[model samples]
Target: MLALTLSLALGTPAQAQDADVHEPSPAERARPDDSVAGSEKLLLTAGVSELEGAAGGGLTPWAVIGGYGTRDQIGASAFYTRVNVPDYHLDGAGALIGFLDRIEFSVAQQRFDTEAVGAALGLGRGFTFRQNIIGLKVKLAGDAVLEQDSWLPQLSVGAQFKKNDRGAVLEAIGAKDDHGIDFYASATKLYLAQSILANVTLRFTRANQIGILGFGGDRNDNYTAQLEGSLAWLLSRNLAIGAEYRMKPDNLGIAGEDDWFDAFIAWAPGKHVSLTLAYADLGNIVIKDRQRGLYASVQIGF
Candidate 1:
């Protein structure tokens, strides 16, 4: 769970301040009540960035497009995040641009620090695995923010193209491939009356460690179906509490990878900036068992 915000797309930074003190921009104030394609006077973090660079939760991508623009406008944002486990560290950064509230394009870079495990594996004391990801998403149907009374949810389809830097090391560890593309479809629903947001995503992937450890392994070279989901409660206009569960594949035969989950709290003190804190259970990584620790992220966008 490592995705994170941008508040520079819709209005001035002052407008993003605490929800209680937030001032509506002219565009937002003039928006029609029936607007469903774009956000209207919503908190900047209403659509959190997903790990793969799409809009949603920390692990699962949702249906909503990224950025702060309305249907008639274009919005964009950039983010950086860090996850610290007992024996490992992960750092990621990315930028996303949304068009007409219908399409999204993004690029992300991830670095996986092996720490002591790198020495154990004879790769040095602080060996790292790096990967670059390019992603695209299209809004397929429905509206997550609007149609609250309807049973239908917003839906989208996305793809992530990942390339790892350590091809030789990956192959040495039984990885069948060092790169691959992942496909996924997601649905998200916002229940304003109930102050809850829920999402579910199904993915077809062959990546190990979400592609940080390379794409496929000798043990399983084919793509497998995986699921990710999130449930959140809006405590206030700019505050939310949530839990996420993401299923992962055990492709490498050397060390087993377990599913991931987290309990998180997100706060947007202003429309331009937001922060998220979480306790994540990453199961096991390499030689370390039960890799659990703090996850933190900060974003500034429009």
Candidate 2:
């Protein structure tokens, strides 16, 4: 997410000076104020929940904190996402709560429907794989917005614990574990003058199919490093266009697991409502090739 919120904050010092020179207007006093001091009001650049329940793009997490909360208050957000690809469909829902812009807690539930492949494997058509995720994030470094002129970027560390319900199925398919954790470190930078935002994340994981097909197989049993990145352009206060790329490890030799990419557009109609639409390419999944799809998500926050 970009730090567009800084633009609003740049006026605070001036506003304070004006207050010393003249009496406040009735309208200014009558208007509703929902944010805390030291924190800007909701910025579209704060971003929405990611697939794994982190604040970021559709496929990867960014360093920005989530929700509308500031440094002195609590904020929360909920989201639902859907992706339809050839021979498969994925649905996810989650919620996140952030505290004082320093810590975040999240939970997510995902269901993957193996439309036709389920039948081919003799597991009835439309068989579904389910997973539950619990995540936590901690802010670790420089602010992406406040220190934009510097070479440093905002940094954070996070972890996601995943548990897949299809243990037997995964074991039968060569998976050695059904539950595991993924750890990641993310950095985000925003150049307000150029209206550009960029983020990079490094993750360590042993999961295949992002844990839907379980973790660590006989073919590969150790966690490995992977990279994910995003670049976005803030076209306006309410609109942003971006692209994301996430690399995956080919752990299970049963089939090739490839990288993922997406082009997306996000719109924030208000501080409490957001929507995102994207075109995604999930390379390959099991027997399916070129798993392209349409991705959509809706989010509400306070």
Best by TM-score: 2
Rate residue 77 of model 1 by lDDT. Answer: 73
The lDDT for every candidate, in the order shown, is: 0.83, 0.87
TM-score of 2: 0.87
- Per residue, candidate 1 scores C-alpha lDDT tens digits across 185-253 of 999888889999998989999999899888788679899999999999999988999999999889999
> How does each model score on TM-score?
0.86, 0.87
RMSD of each: 13.7, 9.8
Alpha-carbon deviation at 121 in model 1, angstroms = 0.7
